[model samples]
Target: GAGVSQSPSNKVTEKGKDVELRCDPISGHTALYWYRQSLGQGLEFLIYFQGNSAPDKSGLPSDRFSAERTGGSVSTLTIQRTQQEDSAVYLCASSLALIGTSGRAGGELFFGEGSRLTVL
Candidate 1:
């Protein structure tokens, strides 16, 4: 794919179940990001991966949420003991340049059609 790709676009799970979401970023992009959007929370950053290593994971809502990137290409987000409050649209994005630079012009991310998770 030319841009970021996410799997299981729609997931419906029972409360307390575990779920894993997958993301495959654009080739050669060193920066990958995971974000969550819900009614209450407009958008929140979950993690930022530079290559296969995550340097910022402070945005994770709780210990139950985790993510990892492998080979600097594919990434996975896992949720443990899922709660109803965890239901939201998970978005993935990638960019060729490093993010959060002081004066980088036109630094944009290619985002995937978010994976919608529903906890019932």
Candidate 2:
């Protein structure tokens, strides 16, 4: 069943123009995460994948941000040349983890209702 979902929840661009955000996870979960919260700021963990491991982007903040999680689920977060501090609110999380992956030892993450980036 679907759970996590994000998309143009709110996006207004114009600065450098370059955006692509979308995420839909929660069907057998394979561990996917991407976060970026501003306007009060506090959740900035750009990437993380489980299953094949080796997909942690170290909280991507520069390089115009980037993300991908194809087969393991659905994920997309690309900001090639946008600016304005890259606006904020692009949260996406998924986790049906078996007993591994993060805090408390991985097992908590089911968010999606974000994707709000405005840079104009």
Candidate 3:
């Protein structure tokens, strides 16, 4: 893919259901991130993965939220037992290098349109 790609642009589900969102980043990008945006609010960092490094899962809001990156190219975010508060736009981004590092244009990020998840 030329840019970050997210699937199922809109999803409406009942409370307590599970949702899986997918992301395919641009080829050769080394870093991937997951973020959440509530209506009228700013992006909240969810998780981050860097090449061969331990993923930073510190931002996940609860145990029900988890993500995994495989082969350093694709990623998935799964939300279990969805709640109304979990409704939001899930965004995925990729960068060639870590932000603030040398080269790679200061870690420019390419973002996907985002997957909108609604819990009824």
Pairs with steric clashes in candidate 1 = none
Model 1, span 1-120: residue lDDT tens: 687899989999999999999999999988888999987778788898989898778899999999988888999999999999999999998988766675543347888999999999
State which candidate has the highest lDDT.
Answer: 1
Better of 1 and 3 by lDDT: 1
Residue 32 Cα positional deviation in candidate 1, in Å, after optimal superposition: 0.3
Provide the lDDT at 112 for model 2: 87
Regions of candidate 2 where Cα sits further than 4 Å from its true position: 13-32, 35-45, 49-57, 62-82, 85-93, 98-116
How would you order the candidates by TM-score, starting with the best?
Answer: 1, 3, 2
lDDT of candidate 2 vs native? 0.80
Better of 1 and 3 by TM-score: 1
Q: Rank the candidates by lDDT, best first.
A: 1, 3, 2
TM-score for each of the candidates: 0.93, 0.31, 0.91
- Across 1-120, the per-residue lDDT of candidate 2 in tens digits comes to 467988979999999899999988888877778888999879888877774353567678787787777777787889988999989988988887733624435447788889899998
Query: Which candidate gets the maximum TM-score versus the true structure?
Result: 1
